[model samples]
Structure formats: structure tokens, C-alpha cells
Target: MARRTTDINDIAFGVIRVRMRLHFMLTPKGDRQAVKYFVIGHPRNGTTTLHKLFVANGLNSFHDSRDWQTGRHDAFSDFGQLRPVAGYDRTYPNARFILNFRPLRHYLNSIATHHQKVFSVQNFINEAYRRAEYFAWALDYFKGRDDFIAVNIEAPGAVRAVADFWGFAVKEPPEGLINNVSTRPKLEQNSANIETALAALDLVEEAGRGCLVSRLNGARQTALLAARDTIRCVQ
Candidate 1:
């Protein structure tokens, strides 16, 4: 009927208008503003998983922040090392944000046991504190708003939830779906570093840093020799 045709036209026009508004928000300054979504927050908490979902669903996505700055990316994952870039949302008010996370020990354990970065336990503790700050600020700023979503990728139906959040059809699972889940395995670190790591950890935990820093004492080091009481309990 003519009425039905008119309704369809109106819907199509509305969509176009939205895209036009977004396009006008900023000139194509760099790889940054071209993006419509910024999947941010600490690593190993499903940041990569969320990004893969976006790309698998056919959105042109980039994983690294620097990579995004060099090209026209529609979605930028892991915007900063462990934080969102300043003024991104205000610059692109139309952009959606996803803060992905997992259990605290699980996150810390991943960082502690990372094959490449184990030598820097102090850095792990430092970054954990930073992640907590980001979460505190983000939750306060973005909670209960439709433009922002906090996704626990480890939670049940997380992938489906993300797809639903974006209203995208998942004809196939996102490529690179593996999450590199946390595990318990003993790893060796220098005793001197362990002592310093724990000292810094205690300081952060006292400051009310979240779960990631609270239980680094024995993370998954059950099998290690008693002399090696490092935070290698979870890997």
C-alpha cells in the first residue's frame, strides 16, 4: 500500500540522516575520527575478543591504537594501553563504547604469566592499578547509558550479547575467537623482583585497587618450591 511504502521510505531516510550527521561531526582527521565504535580498556579481559566480533561481523576494524591512527578504521580496539583516549566520546558523540572485563585474579594472572612480559611484575601491578582507575571512572561516567556497554566476555552468552548490542547478524563465529583463558601454572621470576612486586602490589591494594591486585600473593604457584613464593599461582 502507499502508506506502507511511505513508512519504509521514512525509515530509510532516517538512517541516512544519522549517517550524514556522523559524517559531519568531524572532518576525516585521521584513523581515529573515522571510527564509530571504540572498544577500550585493559587487555586480556576480552578486548581482542570484542574487537574480533566487530571485524567478523564485517566492520572494518583495527586492533592496535597506533594502527588506527595510520588508516581509516571504523572501529578501534584497545585504544590505549589500558585506558580510553581523552575526549573521544565528546568528539564523536554518536560513537558507542564497550568496556570489556573479566575476573580480577584472572586478569592479573594473565598479565603475570604472559610469556613475554613476566620479567616486569612491577609493571603488571602498576597497570592493574591503572585498570582499576579506568573502571572506576568509566563505570561512573557510562553506567546505565545505552551508548556505553560493559561486557564481561567470560559471561554466559557474551558473544551473543555483543552481537545484540550492535544489532549485527553473526552468520559465523568471529575469526580468532580464542580468548587465551586464564590458567594455573607455576612460572619462575627473580626473587628480588618478586619482593619488589609484592611491595608495590600491597601499596596499590591498600589504595583500594580492585580484585586484580588484591590476591597476587599466591595466584597459582601451588606447585612451586616453597622458596619461590611468587605470584605465579594463576597463568
Candidate 2:
């Protein structure tokens, strides 16, 4: 017999579930507080996997940014707004934030290749350079926070680390059961040569340094910086 789902989070991703579990998850999440979490990561960074992880643990999660408004999602990810959540703690006590980042060269190539499905690109070099700044800034902003964590999505122990941070039961993460993949099982494959793509774009030197911090207004930047400094001093 087929199982039933109560949350809309289970309904929206039905048409084409990418980088997500191909099977339905029916794990019962016991009662818990109303703490909300927002994942900070770009496309192809396994944000979908993380979203499903929360869903598997019984937290109603939304893959889209706007879904948080329906009052259904206890978790939110893939928020394309590219904005900062500086005072989330003040707004919602015990709110959690998570960031997933990767090296710039790989990131540039991954996104460019992902976009190749729709609009052809010479390698999305320009867009990569811009996004690199945002990621870098976000990494620093969320750094050293008590309720925030940053992880390397490609790392073997990445799932364990995130589960630990959230205090989920220590068990093997379920199989990704992806609907499709041309390359990485967790992500859709790209025919572009990783090395050739980076070299062709001439992003060699800029690979190490990137993040998009442009959207931050002066007040937010100052507050984030001050908070980080204070947190450091206390430690």
C-alpha cells in the first residue's frame, strides 16, 4: 500500500526531484520545539540532499525560499535571495544556520555545467567570479557562531558532521537514491571537463579567494563584524 504525506514539502518536488531522494520517506519525527533552520548554500552544493535530510528527520522543510511563509516549513533552503540573515537569532531564538561551500574553481565549473542544460555558456566565468565573493562573505559571517556551522559538502564525513550539529541520531545517512546523475551520484553530471573548464575560464589565481558580500548594507556588515569579534573575545 502507498503511504500518505501531510506536509506540502512532500508535494512540491514531485515533478523533477534533482539531487534528492527518489523514494518516499516516512520516518516519524517525535514532538519537538519550533526552532527553524535555514540552509545557506548554492545550487549543486547538495542543498537538496540537506533539505531531504531534514525532511527525513521529520522537520517540515521547504526547498524554496518563499515556502517559509506558508507556516509549514521548519527548515528552509535554496533561498536564491542571496541576502544575509544577520539578526535571525534576535528574531527567533535558537534559530540555526548552516553553510556549505566549495573551492572556487570547482564551484565555477559546477555551476557553469549545471547551466549548460538551459543556456550555453563559455564557462560561466563571470558569474562564478561574482558568486565567489558572496560565498566567501557568507562563510565569514556565519563563522564562530554557536548555532551556525559550515561544512564541505563533498567530504565523506559531511553528512555525519551535519547530523552531529543538529544532534540527529548517529546512524548511516540513507542512500541518496537520486532520480538521475551524469556524474556525481548526489549531483547531476556535467559533460564539461573540470580541469579544462577552469583553465579555459582563466580563473586559476582567483580560485582560493571568493564570496559575494555585496548585498550587505553598512549597518548589517558592521553588526556582523562586531558580533563575530565579540564572540571571539568571549572564547
Instruction: Say which candidate scores most in TM-score.
Output: 1
User: How many clashing residue pairs, candidate 2?
Assistant: 10
Worst 10-residue lDDT window for candidate 2 reads 18-27
The list of candidate 1 runs beyond 4 A from truth reads 1-35, 65-67, 79-86, 115-125, 171-176, 181-235
How many clashes (backbone atoms < 3 Å, residues ≥3 apart in a chain or on different chains) does model 1 have?
5
Candidate 1 C-alpha lDDT tens digits along 1-235: 0001123324653565455445434435454445477776566767677777777878887786343432366677763433333356666656777767765545555656654345555454554445555555565456356766666666677667777866878732646466766564535563334445546555433322223222333333232223122211111
Extract clashing residue pairs from model 2. 132-210, 132-211, 133-211, 133-212, 134-211, 134-212, 135-211, 135-212, 136-211, 183-189
Per-residue lDDT tens digits for candidate 2, residues 1-235, read: 1112233322443333321222112222222345878776666666777777887787788886342432345787874324235534444566787766555656655664454553223324334534544544654665666787665666666766787778877333376622112262322333344444445555445454332222222345555445444321111
- Please identify model 2 stretches exceeding 4 Å from their true place: 1-33, 65-67, 80-84, 87-89, 117-123, 170-172, 177-235
lDDT (C-alpha, whole model) for all candidates? 0.54, 0.51
**Per-prediction TM-score, please?**
0.59, 0.58
Q: Output the TM-score of candidate 1.
A: 0.59
